[model samples]
Target: MMIHKIFPSRKHALHSWNFVMFRFAMLSLLFMMIAAGCSQVERRDDQYSISQEPQRIVPVEMPPSSDIDIAPSESTLSPKKEPETEFGIRLTRADRYSVNSILEKVLEYGITHVQLGGELITTVDDLILNPEKKAFVEAISRRNQSMGIHTYIWSSELNLEGRTFHFNWTAPLVVARQSAYRSVLQAVPEIDGVVLNFENAFLKPWEAVIPAGLPPFSSRERIRFVIDMVRSVVVDEMGKRLLVYAGTGKEEYATWLTEILENYPEEKITVITHASLQGNEFLDVWHPHFRTVGLHRHLLECDLTASAFGGMRFFNCLTDDLYEIWSQSRLHDVKGMIGLVEGEDFSRLATPLQMNLFSLAKMVFQPDIPPDMIWNESIQRVFGLFPASNEGQSLQALLRNSFFWWRRAGMVKGIPLLSYRGDLPEHADLIQPLKLIDSDALHPGIRFLLDELENPRKQTLIDLAQETLETTTWFNRAIRELEHIASSLNPSDYEWLKQRFEQQRLLANVYYYIKQCYWGFRYWEKNKSEEEALILEAHLQRLQQIGEHLEQQINSTDEIFYAKRIRDFVADIRGHFPRVILGWRDRQWNYLSDIRIKQAGPESVELSWTSEQPSISRVFATTGFPIFEITKSAVETPTLEHRVILDGLKRGARYIFKVQCSTEDGKVTNSGEYLFQTMPAPLL
Candidate 1:
């Protein structure tokens, strides 16, 4: 039956506001059908599932060895790091200028160390010429001093310019580069100390400036350079102190650190490492490779004693896993611990500000509370799945998993259509501006054609959307559970919970729109009929309307923190539907099929494909691995026959290849990943 005839009773109502509700009802029915037929989507350990239980609170044990010869508090500064005052936070130069904000956080959290990251200079001239920069440094220094917080300047070996530096690593340097070390020290005399943030260079492959196919400078050279740099700073420049915060798991680097401590006076240097202590107390640890107990033993083996190693500190980075932070602080002879407070670390999570606030309050001020006791209290702080209202045996497990899922879908990372890179396609119909669809424009002729096309992959997308909707539905249920039991929360706690609740609601809306768009795409792709276009167009309008209403409601919300995120979410959602429509109209939808190897020669292969629509095809090939792992990016060619000759394959070796097609209009599609083996070497 034609769509118009199928909904003949509501044909006249299409122009009314009720049209949106009608479309939503139809879309929901479609989702119900697909969801009921689709098998359950596999759930990650962190995802919401009916069978999973909340994580349990596990007590952290002290290190095996007790002989970490920590020094007594020497002066008002206390050389040995402790909780509250010992916690440090690193900020960008932008954050450093936000003095009031920094001070507020410091005062609230009792933070004693503030590390400032900014432009790295190599020469005394570079430092002296930038008076504004020097003034900013001096200002931070004085402010931190008044607040009883020590401020350190943070710099990495691989400077921003993508050049190898002598002071950075053990690379051979001209006299000019040799003087860079003293220049940095002399330029920042007002600062308490400087932190050399040396880590494995392999982690930032993009930042490497070495020759093609060559790796970045190794951490071993960096460690050696640091040791010599510290010696020169103290001996030649008579630099009083320096801080080294290295997050290296390599044993060689740890051994090198041991040598630095044994050689240098403990009072002159402070070594800080990433503590990554957050989440569950049982499984989580500061170091990625081992537990806190194992880390302690490693340090002991390295002879990182209070008297031997001097000032040693550990910090939580990337996550605000406060439960373990409390435990780490109580470790014997451990100098100090720092916590991440700004940028990606904070922006990535829902309720980050509040979580950090609570973490700081408990860790700093409530030092008397035992770490394990605090862990127990914190486990119950966040909402759990299946409260008294739902079936649940484990509160901790629920809290842990909920936080995990919340992080996954909490924010709009990238807008689908508005965030396209490079130039947009010039398809006339695809690029047309969005407008409300007229019922008369519906064409049933293309619907029949669409019904004839077979696309299992398209059906798979619908299945995934169904699964995602199920996940979001459960998330919404958990949010409602929190809302129900939040009466006992204080005003501030309630506000935080409400903010999270609002974000969860926004996330659900995003998932719903995504499912709707997927269905619309399938509908349009199948038929491309006037009726199908109108149907898709109406769905687009419905999505925009939802975004508008959501924005209006959120804007009406008084005094909301992170309000901009919700506003951005609304914009992304509204902008996404039109992009998807353009993709369909422009034939950017990837449907490369009938791929087969025409020739598999000794060193090369010829491949061909037929797609649903004509497109500019590009092929990418890699050997024995994913194409993405290769250094050479994908090559593009507008294929007339949808064929390409791939050269440089080794005989008897396996290769993976994939194709991508984009229309002249802005739409794009990717082919399924393919793999094949070349014939063996020919007998000589």
Candidate 2:
């Protein structure tokens, strides 16, 4: 009250006010210093944040360099490796009577590995045993370059009177046979091993009938005897390991192998058996360590057979059925063994030849390759015997003629398509008139061939075409006869028959036409005749349209129709596309995707998805423990969403996440595989 009255001057009053302000400022500064000190103390008590602050303001501890480890760079890490290569074979055999011709043909076809049958070598053996003929035997063996012995004894009939018992698996007969074969092997040092067909001993009635008093041997005993003989030859005399392979069936012989192998460690010997029996009841004891012998027919029957044969087949002039079987069994690791059989019934052989030729044609022409099963089955049906018929001779002639034509067609068409030997060997050219009228025609054999030919591979086209064409020709003849037979019968008796015949005819024709178009296109392309190639192209389009229509009608409810349609469409385009252009797309589409993840925090997660397509988006997660919700709020941009996802999750918990993205068309554009993690829980 007195200060206002007593204030001497304005200046003096202002100075007094300034002093009061200065004191208040000092007090505020002191309070701020105390609060900052308290904050530092609190931070120290928290432990987590104390060391994270700058040391200039407050003292902070540093972790040891060893305690704070850095991850190794990617360059320091090892890379994933590829599988190692496995040694495999491409085997052939010298058929009896055709040894020289067949061997030459095999060599012509670039076949190196071969098995020389006993009959083929018998003549040579006779010469070798006889001093005068010894040089001839040596010369023949050297000339032929026999890879291995075909078989020591094909039948137990060697025990018959006409033939002195050359070999028996059991008793003294076994020893005697081994000694004989051993001598043969020793004489012919180039020979690899023997191929025995124990089934021959039991297949025929003459072979099956046994003498009343002779000591009986069980199937097991026979197998043991065979094993013993093999051991004697391989282990005793050769001083080296040798293959012991035999032809067997799904019947008793397959069953007998188990007991035989059980007595001896299978690893000690290589045993080759038919794939037909691999999965039968005897499979439990089936030893896989040894080689598995798969005939062409068995190879074509089942995919599993490929596994048995280490992925290969014996490509010989076996029955169509056998060839079909081999084709069906896709033994990828095994190469084909191609050879001509001596004294083979061409009618029987013709089926496989035609089928193989057709397959080759198909391979050359079609964009979509077929599998071996279809070809195998087709060949089997074509070559397999029908019920005894009065038309047997004529049928045989027709089949032979058809086979010849098919072979010719294959040579003409396949050579150009495959760019194979432009010279067109005379042997292939000689068989042209028998070319199947329509390689696509459906018959029992064609159907089988088609089934086998459904999945084509690089090595399969030539053989598949040859098989398919042969099957188509045989099927065409069969369908024609059925049509005629139906025409002769009463309406009621033959109505179904006629319908069936028509249906089969349509299928057969479709197959044959397809083949023809394929080969024609191939031939035209090879000759650089654009117009002819275009004609064949148009023909193929027509056939495909028909096939597509039929397929759609038959498979109305098919879930895979779109896939099949796309496949066929691509195939059609590819069939017309030149090989040079085709290889480009093949390389482009072979890219693979890889994913990696890193953790940022116990509760927070980060992920990245990378690929050619940047538009991909979508993520799926599955955790052993319940997850509330995955949020995309962390990512600000849509395009970069694929880079990472911040998942707020529980600490110390395990989790898995899967991701996928869709195209605007609703098709799956991309997918991210499963990921696992757990968030860290905060400490007290």
**Per-model TM against the reference:** 0.44, 0.30
Best by lDDT: 1
lDDT, model 2: 0.36
> How accurate locally, in lDDT, is each candidate?
0.42, 0.36
User: How far in Å is the alpha carbon of 99 misplaced in model 2?
Assistant: 3.3
Top TM-score prediction, candidate number: 1
Candidate 2 residue spans exceeding 4 A from truth: 1-98, 118-140, 144-175, 201-218, 240-245, 248-250, 262-264, 267-269, 272-327, 331-340, 343-684
User: Mind giving the per-residue lDDT tens digits that candidate 2 earns over 488-529?
Assistant: 334542453334334433433444444444445445544665
Error of 2 at 113 (Å): 2.3
Name the runs in model 1 displaced over 4 angstroms.
Answer: 1-85, 93-98, 104-110, 118-129, 160-184, 187-190, 198-219, 234-236, 239-241, 245-320, 324-335, 343-402, 408-467, 474-500, 512-684
- lDDT per residue for candidate 1 within 174-201, as digits (tens), equals 2223344454444454455556655522
Worst 10 residues of 1 by lDDT: 1-10
